[model samples]
Target: MDKSLNTEQVSVEPQEKRAAKPVDRPFLAMLGMLIGGFVGMLSETSLNIALPSLIAELHVSIGTMQWLVTGYMLVIGIVLPMSSLLQRIFSTRSLILFALCDFIVGAVISAVAPNFAILLIGRMIQGIATGLILPLMFTVATLIFPPYKLGAAMGMIGLVIMFAPAVGPTLAGMILGLLSWHWIFWLFIPFLVVAFILAAKFLPNVGDISKPKIDWLSIILSAIGFGGLVAGVNLASDSGWGSPAVIGTLVVSLLVLAWYIRRQLASKTPILNFRVFKKSQFTTGSILVMLDFAIILSSMYLLPMFWQNGLAIPVALTGIVMLPGGIVNAIVSAVAGRFSDTISTKLLTTLGFGITIVGLILLLLASSTSPMWYVILAHIVIMMGVPLAMSPAQTFGLGALDQQTSGDGSTIMNTFQQIIGAMATAIATSLLAFGSSAAGNVSHRIAFTNGVHVGLWFTLIVAIAALLLSLTIKGQKWA
Candidate 1:
């Protein structure tokens, strides 16, 4: 069977493609996407170290500074629901190539950004590419590779995503150590150009090309609903949560999202499989994943600002301190599945959150006067805790679905995690802003650390909530 359309009978098979191409061509087919994924995720995490500097140079408050991250995520969240529709409408090669070019333009705009508005505009533009590329990577792999090679390809894709975060901070650190933050954006151009070249050369046009009815309603609801909620929460710090703007947006967002859920449940071909929530195991597991994601992103947002802006730690040193955690996280994640086979998902998950709780406590106790050991040890512990829980919990969640909806299960998981992660960071900014205000008449470092403690307390509460959910996870995934 031809690898391109063997199992995919939805479209006619490619007529006269390179039947005698290199056997490794499938790997080549995936190379552009893998590099693109790496660049996207790497840019995501690497910027945490740059946030403090950006805030200082850009003349923005903590609340405004967060748009740099949350805005990027928000755009991705809106784009995810439209991915299925997009995959059917455009060929994989065209979508990816366009996204890469879009990313390069965004990078250039960001590199020369003279102010916060331009910088945010650049980041949001870059986000469109990440959002498009993310789903396409998996879709392309599932398309070009036969079943026997599927697992390895997926694992490699997952690893590259993981590996970027592992290396992103350190590399960004080294670059920032020698140069300004603008260089961070500049660094992507060379790699992206190479990826664009490989993609143009090796990527076969994959996926169905039929124009499905554009589900404008689902897309609109998803965008407005998720976007409004994040915007509301993001606004709450500068404007109190009681402010009409915050309250109004939050209420309207919830109402719209409820309608969106109802519409999806009733549709014959819902874009998202909200029905996956019917399985208790999947629901429990998803909450765990989202919470763990929240924990990770909240920390990523806080720690960089806390260390640099609050405690006066240098950018390079801060990245170096967090480096061990990232490396350990990737290693533990790689092996977490094997251990899940031996240990029950319930116990592994509970234990992982238990460990995470301890880490959060360690961080909670840290302040401006804390030693370097405190930050390093606490970060590594938190890092260790997340993968320990996330991998098995995700496996256990996705396992509960009937094979038919398993794809939906994965899509739901990814979509919510992105929204939740963005929300958590915005909330952290709110807490930080409130804490700083509440701590009037303090030194800058002391004020910043105090605000971080407030955010840490909130993270601790989230971890506890996750731990409680972990305890409820039954051995039987269906229940």
Candidate 2:
């Protein structure tokens, strides 16, 4: 073996001493993670494309169809925090199998459903499965790979996760154009099957199974609290912020969250180790990540709409235009992850946000008649910066914890990303909804511009928040 490979194996040996067998190839493990991550993200993005078809087929209103989007996101957001416990209790094999089964069942149900409500039920089921799979991918990848190689591995996977979904609409559009929307659901089954077989055959069966007993109360409290919080945020996007329904949900969510915190602090075997926040790097890193994701994801969700609806481009062309940005961002994210081990995450993260802010500023100057290349260039800059920021920020965030607690920390970071994505979705959707109605005074072109202007400003605000938070990250290297 090469000396470097030998050194890595030697370092990993102690960590895997308890395993029945060493993982066959860490790269293979990463491939499985990449597949799972790709599929999980694709499920959401493809469904957005397929939604119009489903609505026409089922005779549902747009408002009812909105639930399909909200329901899936809400479930995933709520269940992500519970993944820490799942990682502790279930072996990688069992968890992967469980999540795979969940995706299959939900996909089948949605495919065959007679009504919108039934399809939603299936979507909720699928969301939970996806929720579990998301963090598990990171946990398994982290466990199998040495720290030094984690960034490259995670970056590659992150690229697939981020860019694969950009192709979702194209794929879904092709499928919808050729066959029924049900084929979109059918499309996922084969991928899930492959992921399942690979996971069962090659994935390790390890976990943080040291806890003596499960803490049921903590699980319930966390679920309800996070669920209510996401729901309140989602409701606010559709309804007014001051609405009774939103206020009531927010209040209940806060109360439940408080109780959950108290319970975790007091419990003998807590689901997550809240004490990890003591590390200043971890604290600041998490906030930076949350804000970064909120801005980036919201922009991703909103931009294609501007192109398709505002700019009069076809959906296929929109997907094609968006592809460059997605691929660029994904590549940058992986490169930044590798560089993070040597450079300061603070610098990389700040640079990432700075680039993104410039992109948004450029985007603000755009009109419906603006050249497509300008829009593409704006996104490319943002994408370039993201790679600099995302992986390194995550590595820094999770690196704060001791090895034994890194799993918990990883769960927190993933959960935070999911929540930010969910919250951003709610906020962006609400802004679009409200802005469309409020822009009646402007000409159609200017009205479209105004809506995007408002939304981009929100994204800019999120980017600035991320930039400010990035300043707090310690200039430290992690092995």
Candidate 3:
């Protein structure tokens, strides 16, 4: 975006020395991306707060209103697999500016829509924008920054990812308390508009852009594979996992995904490159990322319900209580990023998962008699551990790639993160339902707490797996 450095070219090689240009404006580009990412993550979590209000105002049943969230996720899942292809077709500046504007348009449309159909359409459009921009943010940062500084820059991006959801519900609750549900969409416009303006003037091209031919077969398979997989998992939380819809969708999705994987491996120009997995650090790091995200997402899903039901905490108060943990998460994500460059990331990841295990133990030990501070402390500890492990894992994975496949690597990581998040939440939901059902003759609150413990135990096991994987990293540097 900064035309002043037109003659200066930055190499894709992380270790390659730059022929240092004085006028390059990479931070401005990153700032715009950070803003765009914040808006996207905020859009993700904030809307749940407004769902009940929107249902009442729109005269829709509870099930229909949830489509606003589920459909948004579905569309995003479909689009994410095509991100590398999209990057090849559009320049960084052009692509990001378009996504920012698209987000703004969707926000405006959702804010003014008078019916459920239009609102759903608007939310889906916003979904597409996020699917395009999120991977690009990672890809751009990977290509632009040198390896030495890249860790801190990735940590800053991690802040946007972790902090937005942390505060989004609180912000939305406060907003809805005073204004109409429409204000939620209205607020997104300003943030995204600022992102668009900054990106237009400063975002520079990173990778070589080639207008590759669209592979329609790959696109269709991916949509059905990813979209169906996400949809099935999402529905499982409400519809029992045994429900025909869930079972059928999951079966069809897995089969299609198998076919899709085979096609990608054989294709010369695959829409989603599966080849990135050949790099062991990238594969190992990605598994760590998925495991960490699942732990975080499942805990986040279960903890609020645990508080509200078992401890009799109010819904609003639960968000307030969670605020401290979010703050700690933001700080740790930033610090961990900088530390990754100087420390052994494998050690950092091992430490992070270790801390997470302690937090989970604290949480499992607490019950109806546990003090509120204990609950908050447990959350804060997990928050610290997750991003501490997550950021470095992310850095380690992307650092393994050459510039040619950075977009593919980023897209692959992002797409898996989403599916893992959904699956974790759904699995937690099922465990709670089953565990509570088995808590024979107990009080409702006690029964639910029993279910919560079961879920926490599952996450604890995953955290241990991640810890073991971190050890296998052997302190090896990727590049």
lDDT scores for all predictions? Answer: 0.79, 0.74, 0.81
Where does model 1 exceed 4 Å of error? 1-31, 138-167, 198-206, 337-343, 402-404, 476-479
Tens-place lDDT digits, model 1, residues 1-479:
67767668646435333222224588898888888888987876788788778778988876788788888888878877677667668887898999999999999999999999998999999988888887777566555655434444555655555556546777777788999988999999999999999999988786667687777898889899878877888888678788998999999999999999898999877877688899988898889988987887787778877888687989988778778888887776666655665567888788889999999999888889899888888988887787778767866776676535655676677678778988898888889877877788989898888999998888889999999999897654421
Q: Which candidate number has the best lDDT?
A: 3
Off by over 4 Å in 2: 1-22, 49-64, 165-167, 173-180, 442-446, 477-479
Kindly give the number of clashing pairs for every candidate: 0, 2, 3
lDDT of 3 by residue, 59-95 (tens): 9754456567667767777888888888788777787
Q: Give lDDT: candidate 3, residue 3.
A: 57
Clashing pairs in 2: 332-387, 333-387
So what's the TM-score on candidate 1? 0.86
Instruction: Please identify which of the two predictions, 2 or 3, would achieve the higher lDDT against the true structure.
Output: 3
Q: After superposing candidate 3, which stretches have Cα over 4 Å from the reference?
A: 1-15, 19-23, 47-70, 109-120, 176-182, 436-444, 475-479
Cα RMSD, model 3: 5.0
For model 3 the TM-score comes to 0.88
